[model samples]
Target: MTLTCIAVDDEPLALGLVSAFIEKTPFLKLVGRYSSAVEALQGLLTQTVDVIFLDIQMPDLTGLELARVLERSNRGAHTTRIIFTTAFDQFALDGFRVDALDYLLKPFNYEEFLRAASKARQYFELVHRPEPAPFVISPAPPQPVEAADDYLFLKAEYQLVRVAHQDILYIEGLKDYVKVYRQSDPAKPLLSLTSLKVLEEKLPPKRFMRVHRSFIVALDQIDAVTRNSVQIGATTIPVSDQYKDAFGQFISRWL
Candidate 1:
């Protein structure tokens, strides 16, 4: 959980203060401190650090230029996150353009520095955490429950995806696999190796219906229904002739 970091500042006092602050923080480990970006570049080549506390303005080489070079060098692996430290407010936007973790304005106290460091720690934790393996639990004797479970887990892309049943908009069968579209994120669908027929049997009959050989629609997610199709968001899912009669009967009860 510890993050190795380095401080780069042209001013001796600023560099010393940042080095001290990094030492004070238990999670932060100071590996090096440089008076210029050029001097820091040499150190970076020999070592791998998780975070970089960079000063915006420095003689010989600017922080923005150094960040760009680091980004190119570490395209897919061992990427370093930069946190720009500067006195001027104008460089804040530029720091973000270089994908800096945080901007610490000049005269920032230890509290503000700690907040920025905490953000960097959280980001690394989320991105670097390993995907959990799927597991199965043994069934126990049924007991009275207060409410129905709202979520189910499905294995996808070698990871278990916890899908909220209420968020599902529809399920589209693709041969032996199915694509689950949900309300929370319409752009991406979860793909898994499970038959549409099996899914249909598992889902609650009151909330979902098989409208076509390859499509199952969530009753509550249907925005509009026509003679031949149902609308959910931008997708127009077809209601085949075989199920039209049952769909019509269901609609009749509602209208």
Candidate 2:
């Protein structure tokens, strides 16, 4: 079982450091991160939040103030455990007043975090009812499937290649051949035997999107776009009419 958590801090470095810690701990999956108390408030209101790592010294709304507000709200009455994160030792009492699961000081070691995480796990197991936490699909507990894990180990001519999830930029179809643009080397795109549509199902929808019948692009790598074409380095690929709706939502957010 995984403990879905979100980290909130006014500082970007603090957010990144906490995110790195969460990544190292596989049981804790990061749902989101916020740089302000206001933004965090909005997310909690809509998203089915389980754990929150809140910093106490934010600008507009102090962490204590935010905690006070959440504690009173009817939504917060449900089983969400908050782990207050802060730099000051003086405010430990304030955190306990709000029923914080654990208090973590900044610049904490992995072992310290693990201890805090263990406490969170205990609280979660004790409180949360046996029900799927809300998401669009409410995906069944991430199970391992051999078909889903399959990735081609390609060798073009003499050079050996290890094609993994992160190595791929996008896929392009040309008749029977599909080209996988290398993420590391943008200048080169590898030709492969796999069908573009078949490989599309293997990749996560959040990371990859079908922009055209003959093309799919990595959402992370897309830098610039026009109405018809999206730029990945020097290459400009067309956005077909078939995937216009999804492409439009992606564009509206980024643009």
Candidate 3:
């Protein structure tokens, strides 16, 4: 199966090189090329590709930041994976943290790029492999009912911990789990086996606002607001372009 892909880099030369590499790969199909992470994010809203050849460092939004957004949003059910291409070797850990398939350091040759592309192709094949039909099909489970506005229960460390809405400072999304930061406990956060999107649906929208794809901040706990980020206590959470207008309106209310 040919994998549809896109190349994103701020530098024209790097973008062109990656695009050319995609074209030469027999198993890969190049769909789009973006100069900035912001442009890539916008393009992704309408375009669905199998993989992304992403650059880690960019002006408005870094590749790591964009990967977090895609992970949280699940790219609207497309499940597009990332293969980071950058000059910085330091971002390798950060790239993997967001589940990047591979990290290609700058000045990489077509052979290196092909190896990464081959790995991606294998992954997609495994994911798309067909399973034998089961004779005894089980019924689907019911969805969880929304909790009360005052509090919610989250399963953490094998126990259902009761968390009050008023005590929460912010929620951070990490892949499939979330770290719920509380006002009472500043240093330690409760880790729950749930997505930020799941928690967002349960929380009262007026009391909490999702400022970033990876973060949902308590509206009342915001201490300060900057051009692209919000300060909650000593921690700063970014407000990405997708949610910037809503967050700006929230800021305008108090000003």
Model 3, position 184, has a per-residue lDDT of: 86
**Alpha-carbon runs more than 4 Å astray in model 1:** 135-255
- Worst-scoring 10-residue span by lDDT in model 2: 152-161
Instruction: Say which prediction, candidate 1 or candidate 2, comes out ahead on TM-score.
Output: 1
Model 2: per-residue Cα lDDT at residue 35? 95
Alpha carbon lDDT of residue 57, candidate 1?
89
Candidate with better lDDT, 1 vs 3: 3
Q: How many residue pairs clash in each candidate at the backbone level?
A: 0, 0, 0
Candidate number that wins on lDDT, 2 or 3: 3
Candidate 3 lDDT trough over 10 residues, lowest sum: 153-162
Relative to the unseen true structure, what is the C-alpha lDDT of residue 103 in candidate 3, on a scale of 0 to 100?
87
lDDT of 2 by residue, 26-117 (tens): 78989989998889898887887777888999999988888888888887456666777788989876676576777888878779878888
TM-score per prediction, in order, is: 0.56, 0.49, 0.53
Pitting candidate 2 against candidate 3, the one with the higher TM-score is: 3
Q: Report the C-alpha lDDT of model 3 over 40-155, residue by residue, as the tens digit.
A: 99999998889999998899999999999999895454589899999998987677567788889999999989888987887788668798565454497656654457998775
Top model number, TM-score = 1
Number of the predicted model whose lDDT against the real structure is largest: 3
Query: Clash number for model 1?
Result: 0
Can you rank all candidates by lDDT, best first? Answer: 3, 1, 2
- lDDT, model 1: 0.86
TM-score of 2: 0.49
